[model samples]
Target: MSDSVTSVEAPEIVVPEGVRLEPERLLDLYWYMLLNRRLEERLVNLYRQGKVIGGVYRSLGQEAESVGTAYALEARDYVSPLIRNLGSILVKGAEPVDILKQYMAKGTGPSRGKDLNIHFGDLSKGFIGPVSMLGDMIPVMAGVALGNRMQGKDSVCLVYIGDGGFSTGASHEGWNFICAQRLPVILVAEDNCYAYSTPTDRQMGNRNMVDRAVGYGCAGVQVDGNDVLRCWHAASEAVSRARSGGGPTLIEVKTYRRKGHAEHDDQRYVPPGELDTWEAKDPVARYERWLLSEEIVDRSQLDQIENRVRAKLDAAVDEAEKAPMPEARTALDGVWSTPRWTAEHPNFHDFAAEIGS
Candidate 1:
């Protein structure tokens, strides 16, 4: 979009030390990243058609970080993603049709039309829904890790926060508590160049976010967020350390937010050449190039993956479009204590039957 765009050289893919991913796992990462991109594209179309109930927040150029990091976690680990980390949700086993239905506010969606966008999560799938209050999820995820420790489980929690969100008092407080208790949690701070219209320089005095990790008494590392392999490597090491009783690790993923804050925003605040610069480092395309160059996947294989992603998204969109909206009477169903709640949590509401009698 800039008049004087500079040609940026793509970085070489160097696999990190002490981390290894099989060819099958590499292809899986590509699948999830492609799925994330295609799904968001479909949502954008639905939004333009006036079908989406809320704004579309895309992770367009940052797919690698989301997919790669979440892929590193085991099934027992918990991930609390932010709005732009939809790729992580897909990696954590969320269905594309369910995400489409949620955006369309269909009754069949995860939240049963009570919420919109990536606002619903399945705890059984090891992911917590994004909190609108930004850094509030830090403390919440710390609690999750604490609960796992209390239950004598080896599970850890990975919580994502933007560079701007990391400056919040809540984030500082939560990190302090996590450090104090030596909780098993991984904090991913996405340095996506800008926060809304404000640049990172204006948001905080310390440009390097990972440096704050030392003040909090934890391990920290910064990685190129556009590199899928690097993201996976960094996250894997952190997960391993946390699972082995090591305290928290702060991972600062250097990336860029190519899209606007939401579909409605024009992103006029961005510098003239900034978008063009980041476009050259597009995560999905870069990863595909690396996969091909390294002989990990053939051109036909990449094409097939793209085709599969498109077909799956097409089906999800069609199914979600035909789904019904929530009925008015069901609005108050989960608003208060009910038989359904008691039935779902018998131990927590043991007096429900007595009250009914």
Candidate 2:
């Protein structure tokens, strides 16, 4: 990465024709999105109930985009999500209980009882945590994949960033390195069309995020992110290419963050009827339609799947609650990076003291 950017092959992965209509997978997308949305709603209710503290990210409208992209990954693969990509984390096998535990500031949480307020780092289930800072994680994800390559393991890294993040220096630097090194990273620009109160029309001088990939010298594409199947097909291809040593792929999924920016945001800048427009192409509804249209599964079958998700979530919450809190000193531990942690450094810093275990 000693460079000014150099050219590489335009990454192109073959998207299997007609995969958008896969019934079982399509319905699973619905269940994943619903579980994330519903659980998030519940968390919000609890946050108000004083059961939880600090801010939270909700996956209301962006469920399909995150879940669909994540469904394409294998279990050993890593997904680095932005704070808002709740659905992405969930799709990566992060259970509702794991999230709830963190919200509750329970010791069972991956970060332990400290810094309970910040949604940062959970290594147990392949998620490193949601970076509150935008676009900072892109290079790190690339480095993770590179490290895996060094180890001769077949893990891939999925770096999920927002459209707003694309404007950052980190995005440019990360993209440059990713291309130069030819890392097998998947750069997912979850474009829900707004960077906080600012719209994409204002921030992006260039129309397509995928277009940025051209300069990076890797393959890129965009999808109708609302259609879960469409997103899935595109992402599945990108992931497969990555697995096959096809270098990196940039995916700009056209999506929207349905809710206000965050719990504290009033969202006055949201254009009238904008949410309604996106909602019509809702991923859950679209995926469900595909499922039924294909006769892949019936309502009862879908219900059974939903029931299992519910049960899993329920049990996870209980487990998290009962999980022992990381000792107050735990944070003081693991400070000095070791070889096994052997990845690059200058990224680690402690906010543990501020949160107070």
Candidate 3:
């Protein structure tokens, strides 16, 4: 059988229960999903052309999970995005040009080329930079949530972790701390069925990861990660509950990464017919069909949105390419090692001065 997934007749568009969104709002959701798809596709081209630094991690088949959960956040809320979560960051107000520039390691990028691709964050936009260590950000997000609660703000923090990362020690420790404190946070495990090249079965014995939440003393719900509306509904409920002092919620988003872990991996480990199955249920295509059948958006409108997204992506790439590389001396510009060392042991620096004398 060919590896390509045939686009068979799509399933019916089921409006998520209790969620009432206008047509315009529905179109907005579709726009973000399309934008994410186009942006990642462009990144792949850039990676192949050797324009991007390090490896290009993509959220290709996981757009619905990212966008839907991000859209549920309020402006005051915060999020800790994972490696494959460009859509979530974009929905939180990150400029695509900045994202491209960051990947290209341009002088004007968020980290001024002092960092790896897509590993910087803007706190102004409520996004925390992704750490290469999987599952480490869970505690960071818990701290952010604690800060908000301490300040008397009803804001919640959302953190994304992959199925592979969810098994890490940091994931369990972070959740343990947050649950004990009754912190306002939502944790979404994007179970894409693979931990790098390893399958979930090899990584964890349990079939459904959500069931683990029972031990953590929090509500856990699973969602169809490919269906944007369904994810949005689940996220909306979790966010509402957290903001209202309902403690934490663990949400498992069932999705897949059609591409390799990064551009470097060939994804040969993926079983035959698995990729085809997911490609047929692509979130962007699925949502597009729903919009058309429901008359929420016509073919012309959808095409127009796609054209705009392509143009925007092209412009972002062009601008990032034109941007200059960072100056070498700027590496020392943001270092704060001395201040932290001095604060930790005030007498240690003075002792060093005495020793020099």
lDDT of each: 0.87, 0.73, 0.84
Structure candidate 3, residue pairs in collision:
none
| Candidate 3 weakest ten by summed lDDT | 1-10
Could you give candidate 2's per-residue lDDT for residues 1-357 as a string of tens digits? 212111211112122465754555656677788887777876787777777757766656678778888888888888988777778777777668767888888766756665553375656677776555677888788788889999998887888888888899987898789889888889888778788889998888886787788788998887767766666777788888888889898888777788777787777898799878767766676666666666778889878877877787677656755777666545545554642222132222333233452
Q: Identify the leading candidate in terms of lDDT.
A: 1
lDDT of 3 at 301: 93
Select the stronger candidate by lDDT from 1 and 3: 1
Candidate 1, after superposition: displacement of residue 113 in Å?
0.8
Q: lDDT per residue, candidate 3, 34-69, as tens digits? A: 888888888889989999998888787799999999
The number of the candidate with the highest TM-score is 1
Candidate 1 has a TM-score of: 0.92
Ranking by lDDT: 1, 3, 2
- Work out the TM-score per prediction: 0.92, 0.82, 0.91
What candidate 2 gets wrong by more than 4 Å, as runs, is 1-23, 117-124, 314-357
Please report how far candidate 3 places residue 192 from its true position, in Å. Answer: 0.0
- Candidate 1, residues 1-357: lDDT per residue as tens digits? 111111224365557776676899989999999999989998999999999998999998999999999999999889999999999999999999999999999988999998889998899999999778979999998889898899999998999999889989889999889988989999999999889989999999998788888788988888888888888988898898898888888888888999999999899898799898889889888888889899988999999988989888888888999999987655645554554444455333444554674
What is the Cα-based lDDT of residue 351 in candidate 3? 49
Model 1 alpha-carbon drift over 4 Å, by segment: 1-10, 336-357
lDDT of 3 at 293: 80
